[model samples]
Target: MKKISKVFFITLFLVVIAVALGVAFPEKFETITGNIKSFVATSFGWYYMLLLSALVILAIFFAVSPYGRIRLGKDHERPDFSTASWVAMLFSAGMGIGLVFYGAAEPLFHYMSNAPLAEEGSNKAFKQGLSYAYFHWGLHVWAMYGVTALSLAFFQFRKDEPGLISSTLKPLFGDKMNGPLGVLIDVLAVFATVFGVATSLGFGAVQINGGLSHLFGFDVGFTSQFIIISIVTILFLISAWSGLSKGIKYLSNANMVLAVILLIVVLVVGPTLLILNMFTETFGLYFQHIIQMSFRTAPLEGDNRGWLDSWTIFYWAWWISWAPFVGMFIARISRGRTIRQFITGVLILPTLIVSIWFAAFGTTAGNVQNSGVDLTQYATELVLFNMFDQLPLSIVLSIVAILLIGSFFITSADSATFVLGMQSTNGSLEPPNTVKVVWGIAQSAVALILLYVGGLAAIQNTIIIAALPFSFVMILMVIALFRALNKEIR
Candidate 1:
């Protein structure tokens, strides 16, 4: 309590007021949030697309430019963690549950229902679906994160500033960052992180409940999801209490292992040849059209424009909202690396790995649907488990997925509490246990409240709305980073 900064109290108060409003007027809450979300997506859709495209370009330039030689810390400093452990922790913290949640469902949606640019249920739609999944989960998503994390690491580790998002802007704002403006910036960051992570937690709970209901005789309702969230909340709070090193590290490693196992199993047990073929083809397709997809606004096509709003714009906002939490966590683990090394590791490596994961899952799901199975009939949360029903060792796959989602849930929530604690406690590397525990509970409560209000739709709407303000903060960070780097070189 003593070590906690005013940001904690202010953000917590805001969160409490939000939860109260959500509970008191659930329908109104849903309607207002949905309307705001639509407006942002419609009006600023081009902005989201352009900003993300610029970030991707900037990330590549940083990796290849002379500035690449700059180290995040002292030139003599070696990395704090092994490359393997560092990748595991960052990947787990960055996009663990999302990969599992949407691995099959998203591609399936595009292939069978609504694709970005192709006719539904056509061969072109099939190829375009996997390619679009790669587009959403690949380079652009990571660039948003890589750029944010790079700014934080360079400022905090090399420039010896406190580990806060606002600190990165000190070059542009100077001592003004220490005043009320800085507090406002940090509050927006904390607010975005809370909702961003809470939405992921909500997805985890829903999918876990979906898996359980598919396996056993359980109901897939708010009641089951409530229990799932409660149990995982307890598990993650315990991990949060154990501090950063022991709990998050081990859980992250477990998440990677489980994820790999599931990926391999799906590849082997499902359409192995098709998965391989699709991976090769989609890999080429994604790279070939990467620029077009990056800047795509679908201005002339009304249907394509709507698709862009629902999927591409929504995902851009989602990654932006998640940038603060994931960026900070990546920076904490990525000490003492050169700017080139950091950008390559963050942008390229993960992009390739996620491409492979989606190829295997998406190809397999598409194959199942092509064989006369109606996967589109099922809800999104249940689609993955239902797809497993067509594969050999279905029970085994479902069990592994459930366990994997649970582990990812704990890792993500635990890491978020740590990040939230850091943001709110004046960027303490090791914030107080009381602060972490409170944040742990607050995020879980937010997940539960959003679930009660309108399920996944409510969560998505809130994320898009929350991300709009912080998106401007990210622009300032990029300018500040370039300013500081120029000064260092001179």
Candidate 2:
């Protein structure tokens, strides 16, 4: 692993140098960026929708299989955290900045450009808008996390291989993983996670800064970003140092409470009737056209193709990029649950909650747009402050928004810190606290630097590029996980 890490860093340095040089020459960089985007757009295209749908089906099958009876840890032992605590961590880490950013924007985006299944400017817009948000937040996204957590719980906690991604692949590679092959997989997972979580950090910083600026009437700048990062780093470091039982357990529970309060407040104060109606219709649409929407790929020549690429493909790629962190975090919390229990906890319950959030929040935002309570002009700005102005109760809503963003950011950072600690210390079930603090601080520093450099878009693009290698690694992980499950059953 150390050797692989060295090689990876060296290669990364070279790539950074190349990119730096490219940046120095604007025309050259623009050409390169365009070519890369074109390739991704064309190759990934509509097929991603079908591919993601297949993955969701596979996860459902695994959830129901006999091997799902296998439990993590000792058969008789109780779990470390309460059910609520466990669920909160799973939801927070899995959802992260996504829920905050997409909560308003996704529905509004879809409302403007209706789904392929809906007529242009039809009444179906509101339903289809929420439907798309739920789809992105639902079973498929959580399933990615489920597979990762299940692999770790069974192999690391139960079977006693090290609690790292490479060890999870041991069922497929056996002794081969002890050498170069294993190190390579671990490197990919780590690098992917760093980039992915960093992207979340970037987004969280920007949004939080935006909210604070609006709430306090202060100017938004890198100073706000730096302050948020500093606070996040300190909080997560403290959490990491306290270890899972004391730190993570409490944080997750607090996060859930805050989330529920925000949700309930929005439900009561916003367009309650409109939200309920839209939610019911959206749920119906989601289930009614599940097959078609899930697998839809408009003809290459049609207008629907753009919408599919922007939303569906973007979502799949985002989930894939986030799989490592989410998987490892779930694995950490799922030590005493059966595979079926793990699946239900990681996939089913979280999806249901996320869908509800989108139903309530997204629908309210859409109603505001449709009813002209606000022009929805700010949604286009991609800044949370501007976006908040579109709603009626901007002040109260902004507070809830800040809490939601801060808690989720902390949730993700703390979990990543714990996972990185475990991975670095030879994958011990309870790695040393020092390791966690180190990684937590490192993540914050990276986030701060990314924020200072070019804000959210730069960080996101960097993460997407870093995630390219891990996309293949996750596919390999699925293969290895199934092989392990098959061997266990046999």
Candidate 3:
């Protein structure tokens, strides 16, 4: 483990140096990274749908198998959080700011552009809009997170392996993972998670800053972004240092309550009929076309292919990028759950919540757009803040929005801090609190730097790149997890 750790960190330090040099000498690095991203985009774009379908199939298999009965913790140990609180923590950490930022904008963007399933000049745009929103927020995305969590929880709590990515692979590699290979895996997981969470923090910070700027009429700039990151980092560090029992459990409960209240307000105060109709139709479309839509990779034969690449492929990659951090966090919280329960709770519940959000928020935005409410102007001018303006009781809506974003960001930050601390401490569940604090501060610094460099897009691109290695690692992990489960169950 010591040798592995040294090699992994040395490699990471080299990569960091390279990234720094690339930033300093953009003329060279830009060309290199651009080419790499383009290659990844094209290669992965070809089979994005197929990959997603396979993921869903795996999810279904895991949910129903006897292996699913295997719980995470010792036989006598009980879960720490109630089911409701557990689900809430999972949702808040998993969804982060994407639910808020994309809830309205994503549907509208698809409505104007038309999704793959929609006919040109068809009035079925709203249906397609909601469908695509759910597509982005639905099962496959959450399954990626579920796989990681289940792997970690099962290995760490059940097998007494350290709670790290490498330990999850032990069933495959056995003691081979115990030396340099294991350390390399753990380091890669940590690096991927840090970058992923930093990306979320960057997006959350920008959106929160934009929302505040709109409410208070302040100028939006890097300063506000930095301040938001700093404050959130501090709060999350405090929570993380306080440990999961007190800090994370309480914050997660509050987050869910706030989220539920916000959704109820939207349902009652917004366009009730439109929201209901859209929710039903969208869910119906999702179910009806589940198989077809899951595997619809647009052939590279026309201009329409660009749309699929931009949206669907990008979403898959984004989910992949987020898997390590979200997966690790879910694993940490799901110690006493069966595989079936874990998958259902993490994948299904989050999908339901995200679908409802899109239905309520997206339908309201769609109605406003079609009804000549001038929301398009706000959407175009100030995309983040405009969604709030369209809601009934705009002031209250803004407050909810702020709370939701803040809560989600803090939850993610806290989870990532805990995960990173565990990784650094050789997979100790009760890792040193000081290590957690340090990682929390490091994540904040990375977020602030990324914000200053090129804002959200830059952070996103970096995260996507960082995810490349971990994506392959995850495929191995899925195989290993199933093998371990089968061995244990039989």
Candidate 4:
């Protein structure tokens, strides 16, 4: 009891209380959260861009530096899982639900609405559509993950630091890291993780509910989403209770398998040649535009030029917000790997998977559009399922997609609860059951309330706002990581 971090506990308690109040007064909470999100966008959206660019630059330097030869653990230690299992866990941790959630919707949205200077529906817009999708989901997002994961893994395994985000920066501040500032970083991390996972769960519920409507004639509304999120919350709590090596691993591997199966089916049934071609072409174009896109921001052009905020900035913020949870989970499973190996696997493999997944699904969606099917009428959550509806064996495929999503939802939630427990319990690798269940319940409740109160679109707003502060923390992490690594090498 005495070892518990009072700062972590108090921060979580305040977060829970605020969320409870939000649930009690839905409109006011939405208004408050909305104002904050808007402020983050209007004021600091460019900061997210600049900060993300810096993080990516730093990650690339670390990967190619001589310091990359350093092992995450002792020289003799090796990875806990096989290569395949490790990659599966990485995908599950990084963005399993996100791929399924945005794979189809984003491409179409980008195709249709090019804001500010975008000539809407132009051939150029279509080109930008695929490029932007690849851009947002590509190396930079993974690099952000790489920054935090490498830092945490290096410090925890090599320096004997605790498995906390704050401790990763101990190199920058020395003993001051053990004081209030360190606690603040970890507290912000916990807060961001809670909302980040909750936002994902909330949007994922929209997908699940949308699937239910497409398959079974259920209506897509708050009640159905609430029930879906509740059932999902319970399953993940049970998984969290089962501990990491068992339930979480089994589900993640299973999800990777199922998700792969779905992608393969789409490739075979849909336009295989076009999908492959788009992937190749987009691969080049993605690299071509990667630099321009990284620093791409709207010129305070007009009232409607906020598209960058809605898409790119939103993505960067969301990815940063998820860095703490994803980074910690990756570090936990990533012991015994070299820094170079970790960065390559973390940055390259997942980016490849994302490209192939989007190529498979996005090509199919394009084919559907070519057949004169207008997909934009369906809700964003329903977009992927709608595209699946037109494919052969739609029912079976949609069911599989939903199950994959549910598995993702479970893995993300369970891992988050585990991380939350660890963060609150003085960085214990194995947190208490009480802490896990409490966090599990609180996470579920926040998702449900956000859904019933603000609907699907509201999900990312809170996360974008929560992620803003953590963006700075992540930069500090990268700086601190390099300083420590350089010292070790010298």
Question: lDDT per residue, candidate 2, 1-490, as tens digits?
Answer: 2212332343245435544553465455445544574467557655556556767777787778897787787778667767888888788788867787778777776776565566744667767888878887887787766776777777877777777888877767789987878767776676666667777887887778767766786667888788888888887787777877877777788888888887887788778888888787888787787787776667657657767766776677667777777888788787888877778777778877888888887777666666655535553324344545665677777887788788788878988877776666567667676656756766676666555555654554455456566766666777887887777788
**Top TM-score hit:** 1
lDDT of every predicted structure (CA atoms) = 0.93, 0.71, 0.76, 0.84
Q: Order candidates by lDDT, high to low.
A: 1, 4, 3, 2
> Model 1: per-residue lDDT, tens digit, 1-490?
2378889999999999999999999999999999999999998999999999999999999999988999999989989888888899999998989999999999989999878788999988988999999999999999999999999999999998988999999999899999899999999999999999999999999999989989997998899988999999899989988877899999999998999999999988889999999999988999999988988888784657778888999999999999999999999989899999999999977998999999999998999999999999998889999999999999999999999999999999999999999999998889888999899999999999999999999999999999999999999999999999998888
Candidate 1 similarity to native, TM-score: 0.99
Root-mean-square deviation of candidate 4? 1.7
Model 2, residue pairs in steric clash = none
lDDT of 3: 0.76
Candidate 1 Cα misplacement greater than 4 A, ranges: none
Q: Which residue runs of candidate 2 sit more than 4 Å off their true CA positions?
A: 1-37, 113-121, 379-394, 452-454
- The best candidate by lDDT is 1
| After superposition, candidate 3 runs with Cα above 4 Å error | 1-19, 22-32, 119-122, 377-381
Q: TM-score for candidate 2, please give it.
A: 0.89
